[model samples]
Target: MRILLTNDDGFYARGLQTLWQVLAEDETFDVSTVAPENQKSATGHSITLNEPIFVTEQQKKGHKGFAVRGNPADCVKLALQGELIPRPDLVISGINNGPNLGTDVFYSGTVSAAMEGVLLGIPSIAVSLAGYNGDDYEDAARFVHHFLKQNNFIEGGLLNINIPPLPANEWKGVKFTKLGKAVYNNVFEHRLDPRGRSYFWQAGSLAPETDPETDLYALQQEYVSITPMHSDLTDYRKLKI
Candidate 1:
């Protein structure tokens, strides 16, 4: 299988690196990566329009890939439209540093990258580890590798996968889930720069999940969550009414 890998956590992120290493080691898979040169988390599906997008060739763990000076969506766009890499059989964006469960997918560059692939008529997946401040991504990466080898991908399909931070043996197993409500207690800390200019840093804490069938609840229960997604956002129920 020909695979294109990407992430919002930048080219040098351990999560991406571990995933790259795992995928590249497989003889049956041809893998290429094009990721943001710097952290582009929460960038969503935004692409660079007015500015020139730059790409640099980089190597990690003995694997060569491109580093884009743009957002995650831009990386996939350029890689596909510009022919930066050969037309891939699949696009996998992540093994992200943190979970992109529920409504967080709306703001997630990781998921956005995968969505871009789906829009371009390719099968895609976005995988994340359900914790921040954790550097171990072996279990997540291995799961992704196994997932790719076991499943047959269809065009226009996108899967948003979230893995718990525990070892594989500790996992309750994988669950097919739906998006949960991600209610955040948002805060913007007002501050002044050294030049006396005002600025605010955005922060928030997520509320606990209560829905059993949701991705968020699956992670809380130590199960890997797989939520199938699509590009359309139409309210079909309302439309039918």
Candidate 2:
């Protein structure tokens, strides 16, 4: 199958590199990669229509990919136009450097890349390792390969998978969980620059949620979290007359 690979963590990110290495080793899969030239984490679904976007050729031994001077969504968008690669049967974004759980999806460039693929009528997935300090990508990459091998992906939606940053043997298995509630208590600490100019630094901490069915809670329990996502943002309950 033709698979388009991209990530918000840029072309050189270890997470993306690990995924590319794993997928490219499979002889049955045809993989093409297009990713940001620099990290574009939390960029959401922003597209670059106003400015000219550029793609640079990059190679990892035998595999060749393109690095786009834009966000994760832009990589998918430009790649789909048939400039860099053929239209893919599947699009897989990330193995993100950090987790994309709960409301974090709203601001995630990883999820947004997959969302853009779904918008173009392709089956997609956003995979993330749940910790920033993770050193192993084996479990996560293998999990993605197994998921695609075992399941049939229908068009029109994407899956968000967040793996606990643990070895395969230590994991508590997988859970299809809902988006969790993780609201941050944000604080803008005002400060003066060297020039005596006013500035602010934003900081926050996650507020806990008790729901066990949520992705956040699943992660806390050491389980891999899988949450299905779609483009529709409608609040259907409110539409009831």
Candidate 3:
């Protein structure tokens, strides 16, 4: 299988590195990476159309990749437009440094990379480890590899996989979940720089209204949550009105 790997956490992120190491071990996978040169978390689906984007070639062991001087979505766009590798059979984003649950997906560059692949008619998945402080990706990467090994990629859309920050044994099981209502407590701390210019830092905590079956709740209970995502934003249910 030919695979394109990417992440919002940039080319040097530990999560992406771990995923690359794990996937490279599989002889069946012809893997390539095209990811951001710097962290672009919470960039959403923005594209760099007005400015020229750049790519730098990188090598590790015998594997080769590119670092994009743009957003996560730009990496995927460049990969396809430039034919960076053989037409990818699958596009896998992340094993992200943090969770992308519920409404968090709206601001996720990781998910946006996978969505770009899906828009181009490729099977894609966005994987995230649901803790900011966790460093172990052994189980998370294993699960992702196993999932692709056991199941055929379903095209036309993408899967959003969020793994709990725990050992495999601690997991309750995998759950196909729905997006939940997770909104942060919006706060902006205003400050002044040495030049006396005003600045603000956006910060908040998750304040989601959870249901047991939703992705937010599933992650809380140590279950792997897989939510199907699509590029279409239309609310089909309202079409009849």
Candidate 4:
């Protein structure tokens, strides 16, 4: 399989690196990476249209890849449309540092990169480890590799996967789930900048998961959540009206 890997956490992130190493170990897989030069978390599907996107060939920590000075979507776009890499059989965006569950997919750069692949007529997957402070991505990376080996890629399909922050043995297995509400208690803190200029810092805390069949709940129960996603935002139920 020819696989293209990307993430919103930059090319140097541990999650991406771990996944790259794991996937490269498989003799049947041909893996290439093109990722952001800097962290582009929660950037959504925005692409660089006006400015020139800079790309550098980089080799770090025994991994070789292209680092683009752009968002996650831009990396995938350039890789697919430009001559950065060969056309891939599959696109895998992440092994992200944090979870992209529920409605977080709408603003997740990790998911957006995968969505870009789907839009370009390739199968894609977005994988995230459901924790912010956790640094261990070995299990998640291994799971992703195993998943690829076990399943055949569907053309133009997209899947959003979230792994619970637990050891492999402790996992409750995988669950096919639906997107759930991700409510946040938002706040804007007013503060003064260095020049005494007023600024507002946006922040929020996510509400606890309650739905049993949702991605959030799957993660909460230590199960790997796999939710099939698509670019269509149409509310088909309302079409009859």
TM-scores for every predicted model: 0.96, 0.96, 0.96, 0.97
Error of 1 at 29 (Å): 0.2
Superposed on all Cα atoms, the candidates' RMSDs to the truth, in angstroms, are: 1.2, 1.2, 1.3, 1.1
Local distance difference test scores for all models: 0.94, 0.91, 0.91, 0.94
> lDDT per residue, candidate 2, 47-155, as tens digits?
9989899889998777689999999999998999755788999999998998999998999999999999999889999999988775699878988888888988864
Predicted structure 2, TM vs. truth: 0.96
Q: lDDT per residue, candidate 1, 102-205, as tens digits?
A: 99999999999999999999999999998887658998899999988799996458999999988899999999999999999999999999999999999998
Q: What is the lDDT of residue 108 in candidate 4?
A: 97
Clashing pairs in 2: none
- Where is the poorest 10-residue window by lDDT in model 2? 148-157
In TM-score terms, candidate 4 sits at: 0.97
Give model 2's clash tally. 0
- Candidate 2 structure lDDT: 0.91
Q: What are the per-residue Cα lDDT tens digits for candidate 3 across 124-204?
A: 999999988856999999999999899888545899999999889899999999988887788999999999999999888
lDDT tens digits, residue span 74-167, model 4:
9999999996999999999999999998998999999999999999999999999998885699999999988988999865699999998888
